[model samples]
Target: MSEGSAVHQWLCWGALYLLAARVALSSETRRPCPQSCHCNSVLQEVNCSDGQLTTVPNSLPQNTKLLNLTHNKMKTLVHWQFQSLPQLLDLDLSDNIMALIEVEAFLGLERLITLRLARNHLKIIPVGVFAGLPELKLLDISSNEILVFLDFTFRDLTALQFFKAADNDLVFISHQAFTGLTSLQELHLDGCNLTAVPTEALTQLSGLRSLHFHQLGLATLQNYSFRQLEHLKELVITSWRWLETLSGNSLFGLNLTSLTIRHCNLRAVPYIPLHHLVYLVYLDLSFNPITDIHRNLLGELLRLQELHLVGGSLLRIEIGAFKGLAHFKLLNVSRNLLTTLEVGAFHSVDTLKTLGLDNNPLACDCRLLWAVPRRLYLDFRGNPPTCTTSDQLQGRYFLDFTESELPGLLTCRQPRILNRRPREVRVDQGHTVGVYCVAEGDPLPSVTWISPQLKPLSSIGRIRALSNGSLEVRYAQPQDSGAYLCVASNAAGNDSLPVSLHVRAFPLSSEKHFRLKGWFAFPSASPGLSGKQNIPFDVKTLMVAATIGFLSFFSSVSVCFIFMFFWSKSRGQIKHTATIAYVPRSAVSSSNGGKGNYMETSRFTMKLI
Candidate 1:
């Protein structure tokens, strides 16, 4: 065997031998109990609680495994206080007046695993007070007057797994206060004076799995509040009355499996943050002011199994509000303002096991028929749902009716036309008209209009069937003048109302005479005669015709002028002017190199015919 392998084998055997020796020594060792304490030999326990002792008791058995000295008046824990009890595994000093614990107080306790200092008057924990406890796994200092945690306060407790510091007047925690707690998994910081999360301090505990925050003065959970807590699996935040907004990315890097947020002043669900928790299994959002669940808000939570939204002001659940939740099992929405539960709100309820709908004023109607058939498979917690409305079924249990009676109990009201009397409507040709009819029913009625020509009028073109059971006809003509029928129908029954419409036609013979007079009327007609009485000619029509005739004559004259001007100019003769030039004799002599400077004058004239 190699040298390294030999040494490992030797160490394993040595650890086994040492464990056996310690057990043998503990079973054989025995000592007399102190006057103020009780000892159990078989269990190796020492209980000195409620003794009111001012100091640690002497004569403790060396093999004691559990030591409890709670409810005492011990003011200090000095060095080597538990040096004699090497095998002690648990020590509880709760309900004491201990104000100080000197360094090296637990120096020799190498195997100690649990220590509780709850309900004490301790305001400060000295550094290195828990340095030698390498195997310590749980430490609780709750219900104290501790105001702050200094840096490296718990650096030596490398194996600590759970730490509780609740119910303290803690104002601050240094960034490196929990620097060496690598194995810490659970932490509770309830009822503190912190205004925000101490993200830097908590990031040192890389293995943390659960965290709780309660009764804080925070108004908002800001973005990236728990950014780097990658292994955290459960989070609880409650009793924050001032909390209003939970930002969209507050839980950015966490993979929490369970989340609870209750007893806050939130007016709406924080859907932006919740959509990121695709692996979430349980969620509780109870006791808020939320009134409705909108569609697609919880659709991304595919693995969600239980949802609790109780004791809120919830009034409605919109259609497909729980879409994409395939594995959902339980939904508790009791004590709300919901009057009816519609089956179309959920994507699928095949996997639902328990449902809570008690304490709501649900009206017993056909809307609840879908849940009645699934009652055999669903478990209704608390009180069974009872009807508070419907004159015949009020104060009756939902499940009391038999399958045969359900058909009669869950019936819809037939559609009834509010206006049943035939009416007459007169409209001028080329004008618009509307025929009116209204309906009332359990389920709203759909309106259809049949025209005078026996054709259904759709809401597409000139003729339209309006939303409120009214028919509108645009540019009414003679063909549109007849009796029109408006039909309103639903699943229960149908109703119809007739309306007589008359479209006034123009006077054709008078119109022809008026046109002929407008074109051939003589200007010698009497000036005092009224156009409508004598001439049947309109002054506005005459002015319009005169304006058109003037514009046409002006346009023709302008075109003829432009063409004649261009033609005359093209046929005219061209003329050019003559040019004459005189050059000096000195200039000619310069051109001749000054040889002939005497009297040389030149004149030239050019012209074109």
Candidate 2:
């Protein structure tokens, strides 16, 4: 993957080189070559990149100002090619099959600003290769197969702003290679296969602002490689896999806004906070094979907004791991095999808005939710909610469940209030007696009832629940002999037990005694065929029964009146004199958590005394 990405990077750089060459060559004038070479005088510039020319084109018309011949079949720079063109301002001969250059190759042109000689098949460049281009601002001679270079290769450039000499087989870059440039802004010398760069190789640019020295294929970097860059805004330095020690001295005075280190094989990152870079926003330390990242190692970056921690092979996430950060917006710890997110791992991220958990084979078991407890309201835009049963999260993208979807798996239990429901049997005329114990459920269960006398009753009375979980006959007649049933239900199903009742024939003993007394004691009365004595009334039994029933009726009337008066006094409360024990706190416990916390409005308590 790394090699393929590098090849793609080279392709992009090749396109950029073509564009720069085309834009800079627009201000130049071109004419016909002296030797039967073709010329396009329509456009002012002459571009001959990747051609089969042998020597420099000493064409006619000295008014030519630009000449680009990158990647051509040329071997040496002839003296006659330099003697002809004195008005040239830009010259490019990059990626050519050139082997050597004569001392008198570039004798005259002193007004050049941009020069490119990259990707050539040269072993060495002579001392005075660019000694005449005094006004050069940008120079790129990268990707050459040069093993060693001369000292005075670039001695006259005083207005240089950017320089790149990367991907060369350069084993050494002399200290006097950049002696005259004082205004360098961005410099890159990466992938040069260098072992060491002398401190004086880059110490001359007094106003250098940005430096890059990545992929040098070195096992170590000289500690003084960045000794002179005091105004740098970005820095990236990476070595081979064996480079384990990144000393604190290597980052002595730089307070760069962006810093990246790859393939360092780091074991730890010590407390080295860059002081003056208040704008430092990004830090990436990838591909290191690190085992741990200590808490708050980058704690001093008050404005660091994003952190990417990929390919580190991290194994543990400790508590306070992200404490004291004020502006870290997005964090990606993806592509790792972390088995657990330890306790308090993100306990102090007050401002973090996004967290990535992709490419990790995290367990989606019941216990994993105990670690995070609940999902926060933060933006979980791209994070996938994992499922236990399938690899494809079952097409549930960012889906979340409320209390209904999770019961014991979410630390929730159904209310036991429904368990103690009294049996209710509703009796209608044509409908069979149905006794169902309807209970609110975390999961609802089916219920049923039973009755006998398969024929339907025409005059069914209003059903009332029996206190003993059974139904009783409010009024019974000879035809009312039957069985009634009450059922209790559960999640599996419901079952009921039958209750039997028998109606026996009642005797008429009172009528027989009254008839005997009337026949024996009294003859036919003259007034109205009365042949019996007058029967005496049972006044004692009747008076006692009447007195008891009257007292009960009076007591019920007084209670009803009192309740009605108080019900009108209350605003939103309905008072009832319950026959069960009522400690108000226990009643309120059903509303709060299991903690039994209660809250009362500061209104008058119209509670029943």
Candidate 3:
């Protein structure tokens, strides 16, 4: 027989064996049911929930495997209350308003596997209350008035695997609170009043695999926070308002495969700290104010498969941000401030099976044309990515445009000069002068200055065009006094603006102004020898000239500073040093992945206590 067939037959045989055992146990006898309670002999279960009983029923069925006393008025469990029911496997005493339990309350129920004491007024648990429940695997004492957990609080639950103590006023935990829980795997401590991660107490769970924390007052995750949790596989944190920092060494010793940090006050990604998580496969950092994903920040995690950054202020994802992630399959960046997705942002789009770009105000242009052929993988089943501010494709969806129609639907906007208003500059001979011209466009058009002589100005001599597209003239002379043009051009088109410059000669003391004006105004003209006019020096003229000169100097200095600022910033940009993995095209489509809505909120929720 084939291996698959053999396994299927084995499973069928196991099911039949379990059914036969249950039937034989049910045929033995029918036990008596206590008053105000329901009993099922076939299932060996007793349910006394919502019965308003004041105490445990002493007449419970002896062979019962499940006992539910939830929603009762029992104030306490007396010593040896369940001694007669040795076969009980599940015991629920939740919402019972039970405030106390004797040290020997669960004396003889040695086979119990699940115990719940949630939503009660219990303030403490005696040391020996759980001394005999050796087979217990799950315990819940959440939503209570418990202030602290004493030493060896759960010393007898050696087989425990899951423990929930959420929504409690837990202020302190003894170092030995979980002394005997050797088999524990998952522990939830959300909504507690603790100041930080209880590292000292968590080291006791050597076999722990998953941990969760939320709504704590921790401001930072210090270095080596979980250094000793060697076997941890997953870690989740949420709703921590004061949490803003994750130290570089915080996750040094962990080999986690999944990590989630949402609804926190983080302004940027903790790249240094995440570098050691080389085995990570899933990362979710939603609802934070992370403005940029600089290159090389996340490339170290080569095993990463999925990344989600929704509802954030993400402005840019630099080139090579996902360079080393060979197995990456999905990327969700919805509801962000991303204007365009650069083509070089990923190593190769071929490996991606699902892409989420919904709810973002995308600028439809050639930058997004690369994604047209991959529309089948864009995850457009729900709300596809739409253009909100593009000149031509606004209110249109990316999936609606085919590869051939991209040239028409996604277009480049022509460059347009911003400062088109003509302004005339008047400076004394040998003084400096600067004319400013700004423009806006797609593809970022380049600027060129045209001299009055109709010659293109270069950065060679006393005249130059600042990197910010402004023209400057040093040691101004009569030849430089004329209309200067500024032209901005890109692949789409070009725009030009004309500005006039006047270099006046110093007037003789005896020369008089033909047209005098107010102190704040410039004189219209002056008596001259032919077309060349001269003006006498005065406080008003000097002030005007000084003001004009200062403006030119300030403009040149400001534009030059802006150019250098951006130049330095670009030079300091980081690049990923990790080597990228290249898989065959056949492997790309064969890889497994999960599809999900980009704009959807987290689905993780706690059980109501």
Candidate 4:
């Protein structure tokens, strides 16, 4: 009980009391989980899914990293509802009936990386609703009734990388709506009511790599619609029924590697500015109304690896159609109206690996023989093409024919006029006139033109015979007004058509004449033409035709003889008729401990064990 001992004891007691107070304060600061929620402190997660709660739960764990309030009946996100959870990394309020989000809803969640408000009833997002989530990388406000995106709506979400606002009633988006999303890589705006490309709005996403705008109400894409998206690599635009024309340069400056535009009403493939898409690798233009695969249509796609033209109205594939696709791998031209395939149509695609030509009306003639060598790489399993031209080969699979049968079957077809020439053509003096003629034969008919004076006319000057057998006459005069003859001859036969040209004097007006010249300067003609008098048949030509006919007939007879011989030999080799006999198994088993039974038939013997 000395003075020093009393002082020491008092100091020790004071220290112990302060330590106890600190422990109590720490315990008071720790928050308890709400009654409807499930908290896992070890994993720092709080889940209140399907709780049917009308309001956001309070007293959430402060250190929670993930908070899921999905399938709740919460109507709104009030200001600072989750302010206490500053360490939150993910917040999912999806499948809720939330219709409104206050400006300061996420006021203090600066460390949040993901926020999902999908499947909610939100009609509009306030400008500062996501103001405090600076580190957010993904935001999904999809499946809502959002009608418009105002300017700077996401101005505070600079770090956002993936954003999905699909399945919304969005009809308009301000030009600066995505001004702050510099780091955005993927944006999905599918199933929106957008009628046109949001070019101005997309200009803000300079670093975006993938964009999805499918199932929209867009009608057309004007030039340079996506010119500002230089870094974009993948673009998907499918199920646009109203979309018809894609203007040249619409995708001019993009470096897209994969582009999908299917199930649209486009009559032809868009003339994409391919010079900018040097890195393009995959392209899909399926389920469109494109009628023809013209030469050089995809010439500039040198790096293209796959092309899809399935379910289209493609009637013809001209020679050199796939001209510049050096690295082309797969070509899908199935389910089209392709009746003839020209030789060397895919000559430029030396690297082609797979070709799909099923579900097409293919004329199994010599023209299709070009694919015989590459048949190993072709896929015809989905409705194999049947012969449509030759009567003997009709309804038979093209792949069933032997190499020897092809030459005779193909050469037997005679030359015929596929496109008839107009009887006459009238044009004003100083204007242009054109005549075309198209023919089809086994050897591909050779076209010749005869002048009015019964002299042969070769392609020269303004009058030239195009490769497609169309004749063009520029600056028509009185002398040019005469009958022109187009003769197409092959080894099988010859066809001649005549077209009369009449030129009328132009009016005495310099302005009108000049306008006519400008307008008719490049008058194009379809493949056809005509004249009087067939060319004199030479003995050499006749002999060659006769030889071809004889050889074809001889080959066909030889094949028939060989088939008959094999059939007769097969009949003679079959000596016995097949018959089945049965006996009781118990009787046979009694001799072998029920291990087996035996039966004898006329053609064979069998034993059951």
Flag regions of model 4 displaced more than 4 Å. 1-45, 272-276, 377-478, 481-609
- Model 4, 174-214: lDDT tens per residue? 99999899999999998998878889999999999999987
lDDT of 3 by residue, 13-36 (tens): 999999999999876754579888
Give the higher-lDDT candidate: 1 or 2: 1
Question: How far out, in Å, is residue 117 in model 3?
Answer: 1.4
TM-score of each: 0.67, 0.54, 0.67, 0.65
Q: Which 10 consecutive positions of candidate 3 have the poorest summed lDDT?
A: 600-609
Scored by lDDT, the top model is 1
Ranking by lDDT: 1, 3, 4, 2
Tens digit of per-residue lDDT, candidate 2, span 1-609: 699999999999999999999877854654445443434454445676655777776554575567778767887876535666676677788868777877646667766677777777778877766566667788887887887656766665678889987787878878777677677888887877676655677777667787877676555554556776778778776655666665556666666778877667666543453433456787777777766667755566777787666767876565556565667776666666664453345534556666665555554433244324335554544674444333433333334644455443423123222445333333322233323244433223223334464432222454344433434444334344456554544322344445454544243355333333544565545323223355533556657989999999999999999987887777566554444444466456665755645654332333464
Q: List runs of model 3 lying over 4 Å from the truth.
A: 1-30, 413-439, 443-609
**What does the lDDT read for residue 81 in candidate 1?**
90
10 residues in a row with least lDDT, candidate 1: 526-535
Clashes of each: 0, 6, 0, 13
Score each candidate by Cα lDDT: 0.86, 0.61, 0.84, 0.82
lDDT of 1 by residue, 221-248 (tens): 9988887799999999998999888988
Q: Tell me how candidate 1 scores on lDDT.
A: 0.86
